[model samples]
Target: MGESLFTKVWNMHKVKTLSSGQDQLFIGLHLIHEVTSPQAFAMLKERGVKVLHPERTFATVDHIVPTKNRQRPFQDELAEKMLAALESNTTDYKISFFNLSTAYQGIVHIIGPELGLTQPGMTIACGDSHTATHGAFGAIAFGIGTSQVRDILATQTMAMNKSKVRRINVSGKLQKGVYAKDVILKIIEVLGVKGGIGYAYEYGGEVIENFTMEERMTVCNMSIEGGARFGYINPDQKTFDYLKGRKFAPQGEAFNRAIRFWKSLASDPDTHYDDVVNIDVSDMAPMITWGIHPGHALEVSKSIPALNRFSVDEKATAQKALEHMQLKEGQSLLGQKISVAFIGSCTNGRISDLREAAQFIKGKKVHKDVFAFVVPGSVQVKKQAEEEGLDKIFEAAGFSWRGAGCSICLGMNDDQLVGDQVCASSSNRNYIGRQGSPTGRTLLMSPAMVAAAAVKGELVDLREVI
Candidate 1:
């Protein structure tokens, strides 16, 4: 029997088994951000400690940094303080910081890949929940809390139990108007939000293999939402092609040597898995989150499922999401009125995402009542979009093209929904208050779908809009 990538990586990183039966795993790359690391750094300061390996840790600011009007001394005093604390801590500790002034600064998850910091076979951890985004490169990545961030900072290791690996085989080519975001949303709906507890998802099959690096990131970015500890794809030529010449990736002969090691990390043909799931995406359509959670979703062309359709344990959340969203059980998400449209986030804020949206929305005017904006995932993405004239296309179509940061994704910055407004958003998660306003309703969809909604000012099938 062959070994799974999870087992191979776990065994390679395992320092020892602890009394609690959890393995003390070494962290290869530790990512830090403004929000979570401040307190952790404070704790380390109180203890009179320095980061164990400053070279392994990287820091940036995303959450709480205003994408627009980014002058210092932000209106949100708390956000300003977090930014200052991160700057001070990184400077004093001699850790690399991607401050706002640098072209490298962006969402931690986004910059990691674009900068080549995330690599195959590495154990990556970050303070943000979407750190699994790195696993798209075949790395073992975890989203940790503040204390765990401190642990990795001081010791370069954290205690964790090994997670059972599940092989997810997604086959079939996606139809036009459907995209990677739709594919992952459908998967989450099928698996249920909590279905992945104690498991690591290894994505494979024709659909995933054919997907671009950005698309893989879209799927892996949501693993945590499904209760999975980590989600990853096997590294292949496509993965190697994407990493080539990247800032932090190996170059020349070093690159050739690294590729050999990276290729060896892929699961062997007869690898064992705790469970397996097979999904077909050929006939799927654009998916929309009608309820609060990512799992509470349905095809844009389909009507919302009645409460009776939910499992017994899901009925309460189903009921609450309906009430909060003010949606009827049998109502169709199609033609639902939307007041805002957002196209950005670690999930769907890449250069490809922008190009696709810009191409579709060109020559179309946004609905008068809808306010729409696009924030690139990173400064480099922003520069590329501008060079390609994508920014002009967006602006002419009545969408605001703003600077890079998390923007409206987490509602930490200035951008957010107001009142009970309904929004068509490309960002992940639609939990109540996820976009700042507790009553604001977020309908999660693909970047192109969000562009379609912006044009019509309502939820519409991408096929019809296109």
Candidate 2:
């Protein structure tokens, strides 16, 4: 039997099997950001050690950077300090830092791929949980804690346990208005929040194969939400085409050689997985998360799940979510009132996402009472959107067009929802207090769906508006 791509990549990066039964794996790319790198850098300073491979490590600021007014001496003192520490650390170690002044600066996950630093058959690590976003390039990428970040910074390797591989085959064509975001939400809903524990999800089948690179990234970006350590799709011509001509991509004869190596990393036809799951998305509809957790979701046309439908072990949490959300059981989320609409995040803040929302919302206006905004995933995406006049379309529709950053996605920056306001957001994670206010409610959906909700001041079927 052939080996899975996970196994192949793991073996290639395996430094040694530790006595504790964990493999010491060399990280091909180590991404860092302001929020998490400060502590790790301090640890290195305390230990009197320098970065083992500064060249392999990259730094950027996103989580705490303000999207609106991005002047120095950030209003949040702690955020300012963190950024300063990152700048100092990167400079001291001679590592590449994509500061705010550089156009390459944006979300760490977004910049890595656009610059061609992430590639197939490599091990990538970052301090952010969504580091799995890089897996869309057919690489083994996983998030690590601050201590683990320090370990990699000092030694260029970190210890990790091997995970079982599960093939998630999504076949058939997706229906109109159904998007990559909906497909992932459906996977999380069916597989349950904990279904992917101890496994690496290998996404395949006709639907995934036909998806664009940005779509694949959106799918892999939320792997952690499903409890998967990492997720990946096999590299193919699409992968090479996207990587070619990128800033850091190989050129000339080197490009050909790199392509051959990348293609070789793809899983064989008969590759065996520890488990397999098959899903057909031909009839899938746009999905929305009604409750706090990502798993508490259903089709737009479906009613919210009643407490009685949950298993005994799930009843308590279900009840808690419903009360916190101030929602009634069995109520359909369609036409639910929304006060805010957010269209950005590592999950759906790429140029394609912006363009999709812009095209759908063109010549339309945001609801009079609703507050709407759009944030690009990276500086490059922001520039591209402006060049394509997507920014003007959103602005004309009364949506606030902000600079690139994580923004309201995590409430780490100044952008956050007010008290008890329900928001239609394209970001991942609908957990309570995820958007700043403890009573603030977040309804997760695609950028287009968010656009629809903004236009109607309520959750409406995107298909009807488009």
The 10-residue segment with the lowest total lDDT in model 1:
60-69
Report the lDDT tens digits of candidate 1 across residue range 1-466: 9999889998999999999999999999999999889889999999998899999999988888887888988888989888999989999999999999999999999999999999999999998889999999999998999999999999999999999999999999888999989988998999989999999999999999999999999999999888897999999999999999999999999999999999999999999899999999888989999999999988898999878988899999999999999998988988899999999999999999998899899999999999999999999999999999999999999999998889888798889899999989999999999999988999999999999999998988998767
TM-score of 1: 0.99
lDDT of 2 by residue, 1-466 (tens): 9888899999999999999999999999999999888899999999899899899999999999999989998988999988999889999999999999998999999999999999999999999989999999999999999999999999999999999999999998888899999999999999988888999999999999999999999999999999998999999999999999999888899999999899889888899898999999888889999888999888998888778999897788889889988889999988899999999999999989998899899999999989999989999999999999999999999999998899988999999999999999999999999998889999999999999999999999887766
What TM-score do all the candidates reach, one by one?
Answer: 0.99, 0.99
Alpha-carbon lDDT of model 1: 0.93
Show where candidate 1 strays beyond 4 Å. Answer: none
RMSD of each: 0.8, 0.7
Q: Rate the local accuracy (lDDT) of all candidates.
A: 0.93, 0.93
Candidate 2 similarity to native, TM-score: 0.99
lDDT of model 1 at residue 282?
86
